[model samples]
Target: MYCYFDGQFMPISEVSISPMDHGFLYGVGFFETFRTYEGYIIDKELHEERMNRALKDVRISLDYSFDEVERWCRRLNEEEGGRDGYFRWNVYAGEEGIGMAADRYDHPHHLLLRKPLQRTERGTSKRGFILEHRRNTPESSMRHKSFNFLNNVKARQEVTSLATEEGILLNADGFVTEGVTSNIFWVKDCVVYTPSRETGLLEGTLRHRLLQLARQHYEVEVGCYEPSDLLNADEVWVTNAVQELVPLHEIDHVSFLGKEGPVYSDLHEQYTEYVKERVSEQC
Candidate 1:
């Protein structure tokens, strides 16, 4: 595999960073992950927009433009023979001597990495378990894809089964916030519902798209919801950039009626068509 470091493309094995870098020492960095289809990034603009907001929030100076980033992605994809894959763009404090102060870093370094994505079987449903750990609210409010991911890592470790797709994380208030890596949504009585951003969940790009798409055909509600709400839901779904949309068949002891419920099926079909259209536009 190859990755873009600084301003050059090199083998991932040869890439190295200073051990004293602020990103490594203090976890001061921001990143965005999205999928590419046939060399084109899905929702490139949306990702860029979110990245800009996150960088500003963390007081990281923006030195690169979205167009330049896109060009590099296209170049790397071509170099890799144009395979569909997942990509991560990371911007971190470049200062070698970091002492928990951002003022020391004059400029940040950006790295782009890609890895081939294995396609999953069609109609596959994800099984999740409500984790014992609750999301720490105040810090989670940032909602940026920062380098501090130990919380998510620990939550993911609780998923003992390989078949479990994700671990559902609740907020301190005992409200379902989101999955360890994706946003959570459920349907009850033909209404689609998901946790609001106030619940300390990241506003995922796919989650926003799905909400917009579903709103056209169903009443989409965003608010704090408890575990019982999900357990009694007629259908449950999780959304992220890579997995896209995954219907939930079971959560812990509560098993849903069907593998893919009617609401999920319709929205998934529409989402697929939407993706095709976007990819074609890039072509």
Candidate 2:
């Protein structure tokens, strides 16, 4: 497959980087994962804005412009037959001297990965996730989508062993925050609720859109919530750019009838139409 590095497009096999890259050595990098629909990149602007915010938060300088990245992404989508596939954008400090000093010369790298869409269905449609409440400290880059993901990986592995789709993280005070790879949402008495941005959750693009849509149908509130709120929720769901929205039928051992619920069906239908409209713009 063809990939983008620095400013050039080349075969993925020919891509190379230094062994002292900060991303590999100290995990000091920011990245975003998005998918394409037809020839258009989904939520293109929002993803770029978020990546910019992440870069600012981590003090990583992005050497390329957003338009340049967008053009390259669109080209990859069309050339690699990526009608439906994932794309990864990475920016990190380049290899420098061996010490862990914060001072170093940094050169950002960009990679465009193309592959067939992966449709993974785990657990029942009506079943939700059983999260082991563990929160990485604020200093650990939990709020940024950086390359340091060993903590998330370890938690996800534990949840997978227990046969769950995703894991939920809670802050030190025991308030539900977010999932390892997605954002969490729930419906109660026809009102939708999610954790506030102050909870250190990565701002998900799809999560932002769904909240706007939900506001039209019901009251949407962002606040701190405990795990008990999830157990009591009449309906639960998770959202990501690729997954869209999937109903959560259970949390931990608690069973919830989310998939067959009226709220879930209605939102899912609306989300499908939203996608169709965006993808049709490319044609």
Candidate 3:
């Protein structure tokens, strides 16, 4: 695989970063992940918009233009000689600099890489999950896909290493937030329920579209949900741009009847159509 770093393209193995970089030292940076289909980026505008928003939040100066980033992505795609893959583009606090502090840094670096997209097994588990709250809060920087991921990483490790697929995160007040790396959604009486923006959920690219499309056929509620709400949910699912809509067979150990639920099927169908529309638009 090839990666673009600090204004140059290089093999992934050849790419390097300084230990002093804030992205590593202080976890100050922004990143976006998107997939390619038939050599075109999926939801390119949305990814860029989120990344730009991250930059805006931290008041970081971007030296490169949006067109430059797109150009680099296109070049890397061509060099990869493939039509479909995963792309993770990052802008990190650069090397040590004057007036450096943990609050912020200077001269952030840019890195973009392309890799093969791997799919997880779907339609396998018919059980739901049992979960323990991680006690995270929206004010704790949960929204940014920053280099700092210890919280989500640790929480995920607790679930994934046990052979379970995903876990739910909770806010400090015990309200359900999201999954390890994706947005959480559940179906109840033909309505879709997901964490609201106030819960500090990352406004995921697929998540936004999923909500929009779902509203066309069913009521989509973006609001706080507790474990009790999930317990009564007819069906539960999680979504990310990469994974799309995946049913949650179990939450912790409780089996959910999500496998054959009509609401899950509707959202899944809309999600598929959303992807198709975007890919078709690109073409």
Residues 84-116, candidate 1: write the lDDT tens digits: 677899988777684677354567888999887
Backbone clashes counted, model 3? 14
Best by lDDT: 1
Q: What overall lDDT goes with each candidate model?
A: 0.83, 0.73, 0.73
For candidate 3, which ten residues in a row score worst on lDDT?
122-131
What is the alpha-carbon RMSD of candidate 3 to the true structure? 2.8
Tens digits of lDDT, candidate 3, 172-203: 77788877777888888878899887777778
Query: What TM-score do all the candidates reach, one by one?
Result: 0.94, 0.87, 0.87
Which segments of model 3 are wrong by more than 4 Å? 65-71, 97-106, 120-130, 133-135, 139-142, 161-164
Per model, state how many residue pairs clash.
0, 4, 14
Question: 104-213, model 2: which lDDT tens digit per residue?
Answer: 44566666666656666622363445456566655535467778777678667766442236677787778888777788898888888899877777779999888877
lDDT score of residue 221 within candidate 3:
82
